[model samples]
Target: MKSIKTKHRIIKAVSALTALVLASGMLAGCGGSSDKDSEGRTIISVGSWPPEESDALTAMNERKARFEEANPDVVIEPDEWAFDRQTFYAKAAGGQLPTVYLSGFTEMPEIINSGYSSDITEALKNNGLEGMFNENIMDIISRDGKIYAFPTMSYVLGLAYNVDAFEAAGLMKEDGTPMQPANWDEMVDFAVKIKEATGKPGIVLPTADRSGGWIFSAIAWSFGVEFMEKGEDGKWQAKFDSPEAAQALQFIKDLKWKYDLLPASTIINAEDWYRSFAVGDGAMTVVAGDYPRRVAKYGMTPDQSGIMAIPAGPAKHVTLLGGEVMCIKNDATPDQIDASVRWLKTRYNNELTDEYKTNTETTTENAKKDGQLVGIQSLSPWSDKAESLVWYRDYIEQNANCNLNHVKLYNDFVADCPAEIKPEEPVC
Candidate 1:
């Protein structure tokens, strides 16, 4: 019989909002030229612009046109440069970045300390967006009481499992729900069953590009391991050299050697891990709540996959929080910052206006029409009380395309444990 547990668990509080950070290369001028365009509009370069062949480009251009129509003095120049750890530094150092661009939420420290991101507190205030964001998310991008970036989306990690694999392994219940692991030990047994039935790797983890370490931390956390802690001398000390951490590491080792649940290649990157899981090379992988959209393009159907809270460890049931943010360039002129703030508000469809409402409706409708996954649950960047969130929530419910049964466990855990959600280690 497939063993099922009633208790749902989630990660410690690591609050973040997930948005595409739009950063310009260091070489690109916030306004490529100080002089106005022939039409006398102030030009602002932005990143996360879809490629010419992308399906999202049309929607992006439409939003840009509307923003320009509403604010005639500003012109939005889209840059195709994307955010990556390696190229980000190259762009920042070379001065080719845009006026405002995309970046991960965790990169705030490096971006701000390196002087790549501008202080947008006053700009946010001016735009009436000062107190609109979730405070916990805002905290991640703020330093010394100053806000540096805008939180756009939020996410928490969950274990994504292949429904087909579960059924094939006889791990599915009569009600059509897969029998999920309640703890890490059960996860191993479940993987063994999956491997025996499917003749495929039962679980996958990224082992390259520091993704291995990233995935390791969550596992270690669940084992009651603290990567760091303040000592009596008031200095933060590395604490991972503990029994709990060793157990976590040993668990991973056994997954490969003893249980033989890992893939043929151990050197997987994050992208590879996701794609592998999507294509059914592995029965399960850890992913964020919004990761369904990412795997969708890989031909993973909604009914074929489901997400549940990460299996609990001996010490606790916890996961990692991650997301993205948008920031202004440090060198952007004040006028440029103001323009960027207005543009950001418009781009995110967060402003409280009839025009914004129409834009939101249109965007959601378009996603639905395109058969894009419409309703994977995500944390709101705005506060719970924000009117924008209310409508946005309603719209998601009304247009959701994915199977809610697939995501109910993770979503339910999130709804039930607001206080338990915690931030990840800053250095990771």
Candidate 2:
């Protein structure tokens, strides 16, 4: 029996909206190039790749085109850089910076420290898109209580299963959807039943060290890690060594030892882990914000594969919040910031622009057919539709899941990575 207990606590979106409005006035005008012309184009550079074939790179190029179409006078240039967490700052330095660009939410500190990006308060105000992002995440990017970035994805970490694997394991739902196990015990039972039925490992256990760390953090959090809380001294305290964290770590240790259902080589790298998934080593695996689309391309369509959140635990049902956020350059001139806002609002809220937006990037815009969980708390769009870019407003109206809270606690996890691995090359 999956005995994990989960209680959901969602932060109110109203508070976020309230904060955003108040925040816009704080950084009313950014300082940047004063040039202004209806015919003038602000060169917005982005990290992109080409000539060398890469799926992710292709996706970026497709979106770049759509942005140009929507803002006829803006030139969105490719700010090519390695996708590693390190190189982004280097690119941000060379003055090769775009008026605006995408970046990781947690990494905002680096940007703030460097003073490369514009403070987005005014742009967010002009478009009325402020504070709509996950509140906690907004807190993460904020310094001295001012907003700097716009959170875009509301992703929930969940299981993505192989339909063929399920059929082979006799685990399909009566509705013919692939079985998506909900909590931990159910997950283990399903894994065992499948392996017994098919002689293959039941869960691949995403062995890549850092990736596994991501899953492990969610598990520990679901198991109840009292992360980031005001300490007795009233400072943010790190709690990775807590009992709950240890238990979570032990659970992972058990999966590797007692479960005996995962292949060692599989844990070596993320690509290898996905390959095991593609070959149907199990009925299910932990899929991140981007992997469901990869699963769809594996053999069956996304609908056929079926998806659901991570297993519940005794403490809380939480998924490690991951993905990117778009922030403003703190140094950008007021005019440049406004121009960027015009483009951002069109892309962020414009209803008619999504399909064109998704199509250009080749991200799967239609992953929400079974619908999505767009928690105002979690903020970033749950877009596994790597090739789809339908307007987010339409998505939010139809499939938004209301319970997501961008739990500030889960942000401290550092992948306990092994030394043998190397990061894959960036697409752009």
Candidate 3:
């Protein structure tokens, strides 16, 4: 998860009318510009939302500087415009989109169908990156043989838990390691033990908005439920109303209503829940691989936390894969589109070139200097499974900042998990 800090302060609740006015003001200011600068260089904006003092923000600035040096005719504009559901469409319709914007893999179909993204098939082919992407992920941005965006990163849902709390609860094995639960029942039992022993909430399950549904889909899929399935006619239809889905929902409801495994609030968004977990308020929660970076910002050390694969269900284990895609605005000129693609390749997709190796080395060295974790395992969008594994091996060997044993369970799980990986829901 990307860390975007928000300040908390006590204030009187706003009246309904005032709230509406505030919302209107927010929507009214969603526009951005893409005109040439005084120097006559085409301005190509990129979207990022890194915390002020984070290594990520520093890396992004460095990349922007390098991009500008390489493409002097184009000026790189750094926009702090992270993806927001409420303002996205308004910005797109107003021609205020950054030249390159980040979007969830699940949002591509809707963005493409709504004519918000440019067709980048020819651009990718021209750059020889058409065949570089993992086919499974490429399909997320491709429709009828036209590509709309480039997949930048991919992730799977997993169980993030506090090691100290688990040990206090005697949830660890005799070998001084976490006790890996094999199924949903064992997981619930373990959560109960952690709560009884630590006097803290057993687990936090986000039940608020789209995130609740997203995490629930992972559980539902693990329960052998396919929320949406392709019919014989090749059209997608909702299948979430099945018994398996009911079982999954019941499990979550039991955590809150019956088991009292969650907090009293009963509804928590992703950021709030992650904060709760980071501060050691809860023992476990569902999260992606990059969650540790967020936890670190909250003062949690690497040894204090660990991640494991989602527990197996009655049928088998499955994980829902999701990630971000880099897209160009539909209104971009041909030159702007080419420059955007070139920027993307230089920054993210240069893995096959010698420049990429040098870049990787430099990034690892810099991360070491900045005290950043170098080799946290994550799914790749540009390479197939085999190639990704090879890349990861070399990367960890040269760049790992933490002990691999800290997340050994997660590593083992990813290595042994079934190949039947499921993608996010296709219906936008």
Candidate 4:
């Protein structure tokens, strides 16, 4: 809880201005027909995320093209994927958000809580997609007892380890090959080896005054503890003071301090988690499932990196579920909602997966070839990838997402709370 010190409530509203959400930018929603369809259906406006051309934009362009050719009268307006938490909040607060916007599974609470999204519980029920979604995504979007957004894709967390490092540290197979540690103790031992030999930080989180608390939150959750819980009154209440919670927090702190594995500086921005792991400055890093896939672009091969479930905590092995999702504005016409659904159906189709799946699957394959991962969707495609990527196949059953169960009450908690915990800044 040591990240953003400012409150969403305190944010000075950005007057209406367009913005992009992710690295890839937005994809157009429909083909040439972004207005009325051949049969005169109203043009529907949609937003794309990661804003640039990757598999997503390409797949979108292809699908939107087909959707337009099939229905000449229906125009599709695929706006840039610019809206994110702050922008979404601003639009919701000002009521300027689009009829349809896309985002992640973890974003549901913030979306609905801000009052811009509407419950499509009935629509989902009618469309037979009600059962197709995972409970985690549905739970996050539900507010005042209603479901808001629909899931688009799913993803989860895993431990990305260096295969060579594991062998070099004597933590791998007899052949000094790839494998994951069975528990936390062995995990920490390997980190120490990397530190002793490499003279680099063991595992990176964040320790800067303005960052580093996300690692704490994820670790705490992985131990089956929710740092905050909703009271009978339904408002979010901080719960990081429990014995188990304290133990989990202290264990990580000790790793940074006493054990000399996690450097105190590892406690800064969540972004460091990427740099340290991707650059091979750390032997092991617990991160999103997409970590190895994304790092492949940077030349971190499979033989050098691999992924596996985080070691089981004393309580349980856990991961924070995350991924993109779709939501239509409450005020949108029925036509808008239908159009949003049309786009979602197209994006999630197996045919589309054949196109987009490679972003991850291809990366996974490459990582595996170099010893970087087990397999993106192979671990438990039924549970982990089912409904989407959070579970992939069948990696885990019970998840720690959804608004009611245990969601981050504040976006900057990772940076701010730790600042509160010790008050003293790191020496570095």
Best by TM-score: 1
lDDT of each: 0.77, 0.53, 0.75, 0.55
Q: Please report the TM-score between candidate 4 and the true structure.
A: 0.68
lDDT of 4 by residue, 204-305 (tens): 555554334544555676565656666799667776677788888788778777787764355445456566666766777766555655565567654466
- The weakest ten consecutive residues by lDDT in model 4 span 419-428
lDDT of 1 by residue, 1-428 (tens): 01112111111111111111123224342323572578777779889899796658987898899889999999898888778876676556545678888988767766877778999999989988878887657668898999999888777777889989998999887666667688889998999999999999999988888778777878889888888776798545787889998899899889999888998887899789888998888998877776666777788776778887888888888877678899887878888899999999887756567876787778777655544456655666787657777777777777667666666776676555432455667553
For model 1, the stretches where C-alpha displacement exceeds 4 angstroms are 1-41, 51-55, 84-96, 168-174, 178-180, 195-200, 226-242, 352-374, 418-425
| Candidate 3 per-residue lDDT over residues 48-97, each given as its tens digit | 64648787888888878877898898888778888877778766765667
Greater-lDDT candidate between 2 and 4:
4
| lDDT of model 4 at position 102 | 76
lDDT of 4: 0.55
TM-score against truth, every candidate: 0.78, 0.65, 0.74, 0.68
Q: For candidate 1, what is the TM-score?
A: 0.78
Ranking by TM-score: 1, 3, 4, 2
Please report the TM-score between candidate 2 and the true structure: 0.65
**Candidate 1 to native Cα RMSD, angstroms:** 11.3
Regions more than 4 Å wrong, model 2: 1-78, 82-84, 88-96, 109-116, 128-145, 167-170, 177-182, 226-238, 264-266, 296-304, 347-349, 353-428
Candidate 3 global lDDT:
0.75
Model 2, 1-428: lDDT tens per residue?
11112111112333455467668774333323234444676655444234365875675576568777877777764555434555554434434345566776456665675576667776666765554554435455567766676555544466666556677778875555445455677888888877787788777766566666655556666777655554687445566678887887777666658886666554446666666776676567776645644554455443334444556776665565555666655556676676667766655543344465544233223544423223112224323232222344344334433211121111111111111111111111
Q: Which candidate is the best by lDDT?
A: 1
- List the pairs of residues colliding in candidate 3: none
